[model samples]
Target: MMGSVAQLWRHPIKSHGREALEAVTLSVGQCMPLDRHWAVTHEASRFDGTGWVSCQNFMIGARTPGLAGLWARVDEEARRVTLTHRDLGELTFAPDDPAEAARFLDWIAPLCPENRARPSAVVSVQGRGMTDSDFPSISVMNLSSHRAVAQKLGRDIEPERWRGNIWLDGLGPWEEFEWIGKTIRIGSASLHVRKRITRCLHTAANPITGKRDTATLDALEVGWGHCDFGVYCEVIDGGDIRLGDKSEVL
Candidate 1:
């Protein structure tokens, strides 16, 4: 039987930054620790007033080459975040400061010229108007499935391209699909495999360089007959998930 926890990932800011973890603990149905806990929204926006914005609206991609260089770090204990770009040093924010949200919006505006909203109108994912495109939460990737696509693409694909919250390394190729409708154990925690994650334009964007190259998606379609590259799971039993934790398909 395939076993072992292959990878762990968390996105501190929704659609803006990602962090890889050597270990993590999660609560039942909680989002991968701090993953997508924060998000950036348009200048003029209200979370519930407007529908959830699609990631395609803003993210490091063909539209914003500079976003690739954006690196963000969160000090959860301090309730603060720091974002860094090549030309700029570090810009910090207090998660609670009412003005902090607006500051973040201004920071992203110049870089995202495609957005017509004024620079000062920034909003957070937790703010009134923000929500992920679909699903209440997101997490993980199957390493074998990721590799299969790379093999078919005839290129080395970076995990950033898929932007999965967790990247599992030990499972069989396309094995995660089989995990659907089942519960798997990671450390003491258990997660129920919900369904497959279908591919989108984000897959075409190079996760590292944030360049638009559809080769990855093309490979998936021609080789696998589908664009899916990962699976989604909802936490069942909660516990610490560390690197190399045993994974048992139950």
Candidate 2:
């Protein structure tokens, strides 16, 4: 069976917002370009600039639900990020400067739970994309599986809950699991399937509202007996991936 890229996304700032892309240049040993290259570190969280850190240190949707509603765009050349929210309107800031981190926090402070650490600073490593997986990763999801979950829930769910880098259509529900330990040729790029992506509380939050409206983990448990939805892939060969590009299990 064959699948085709349905959408491409890059989150310039980790857990802050999502940027929809028509095409992206992916490379071996890296996540999507400009994806998760910067993150807002919370107070008391220890994430040094030297290596990959766990997502818990960052202000993500799971911890700050309002962040799920954020829509962002990035100008890589300009190193500028713009985020929009229905409640917050829009704000643009440079993530690299120490002076701008406080403003970024001010914009997001409304969403922070009182118990959670307050946003303190923005952190980044120029060449490495901080990902959920311990190693560098590109998240991929099957659209058919998303629909199947929606069928189980009897309503539609947003793909943003999964926060994937690649969305593929024309594959069976849960068909991506079979691709584990295999190589996938997507457009001009190749990726090695690393593992099934586990579900998290973030899945229950609406992408537009950030409210815990869906029972995705529950739906997965009832329908599939596991809390897994997507797959993580490691880029093996670098190239451009465009919308509607062929995605093949090689």
- Candidate 2 C-alpha lDDT tens digits along 1-250: 9999999998888888999999988888998888898888888788887888899888888778778888899888889999999888899988887677678888889988899888888998767888888888999999999999999999998988889999999998899999999999999999999999998888899888878899999999999999998999999999999999999999
Give the alpha carbon lDDT tens digit for every residue of 74-154 in model 1: 787897878776555568887457688667766766666465543333334442222243644545578888788887777
Q: How much is 33 displaced in model 1, in angstroms?
A: 2.4
Each prediction's TM-score against the native?
0.83, 0.98
> Where is the poorest 10-residue window by lDDT in model 1?
122-131
Q: Which stretches of candidate 1 lie over 4 Å from their true place?
A: 43-46, 49-68, 87-89, 115-135
Error of 2 at 101 (Å): 1.9
Error of 1 at 122 (Å): 5.3
Per-candidate clashes come to 7, 0
Question: lDDT at 98 for candidate 2?
Answer: 69
lDDT of 1: 0.66
Clashing residue pairs, backbone N/CA/C < 3 A, model 2: none
Which one is best on TM-score?
A: 2
